[model samples]
Target: MNLSVNVQEEQGTAVVYLAGEVDVYTAPALKETLLPLTEQSSTTVIVNLSDVTYIDSTGLGIFIGALKSSGKAGSKLKITGANVRVKRLFTITGLNEVLDIEEDQREEV
Candidate 1:
């Protein structure tokens, strides 16, 4: 699986732009990429999946883990630009209820 992440720091937020598959083979990379940002700044983490093409359970776990870490640090973690398939994964896993997800401007849970 190939994954690419571009992180941009702005004021009080880190915008992470993700692309490619986020699965067991790549989830760890995702975690590692975000860890430094989480530790270095007290800013809201925004994961933008507009360019992401695919994701699996392991990827979901990474997001959940990031959320947990951000919560512990009193920072916010949000997911945005999820496509229909990714949105379905979140819904089926009940992750939509636990995380702040926004698609095209409409907020879900």
Candidate 2:
């Protein structure tokens, strides 16, 4: 299915909550929502994937682009609450080393 993206502002941070599948079909919506936040100077953009069930390479690419945007804008990008499978994708791609991913205590198989 479809990906649901919601954004909330907390202090100086923009938190984006995502659910459902993040594939090529849904990546554009995510990019639209997330990219602008990353472009804001001195802002912190957090992508919360706690409710997301699936994600593909296209979704990962969006985050990578957001990371780059954040750097150029002097902002911060963080990803949190990723499931085991999703976290493994970042690890395998070696993005975990370059991106700031907060550990999620909940584990899923």
The candidate that wins on lDDT is: 2
Global lDDT of each candidate: 0.85, 0.94
Range of the 10 consecutive residues with the lowest summed lDDT in candidate 2: 100-109
* TM-scores, one per candidate: 0.89, 0.96
Q: Candidate 2 lDDT, tens digit per residue, 1-109?
A: 9999999997889999999999999999999999999999999998999998888999999999999999999999999999988999999999999999999977555
Question: What are the clashing pairs of model 1?
Answer: none
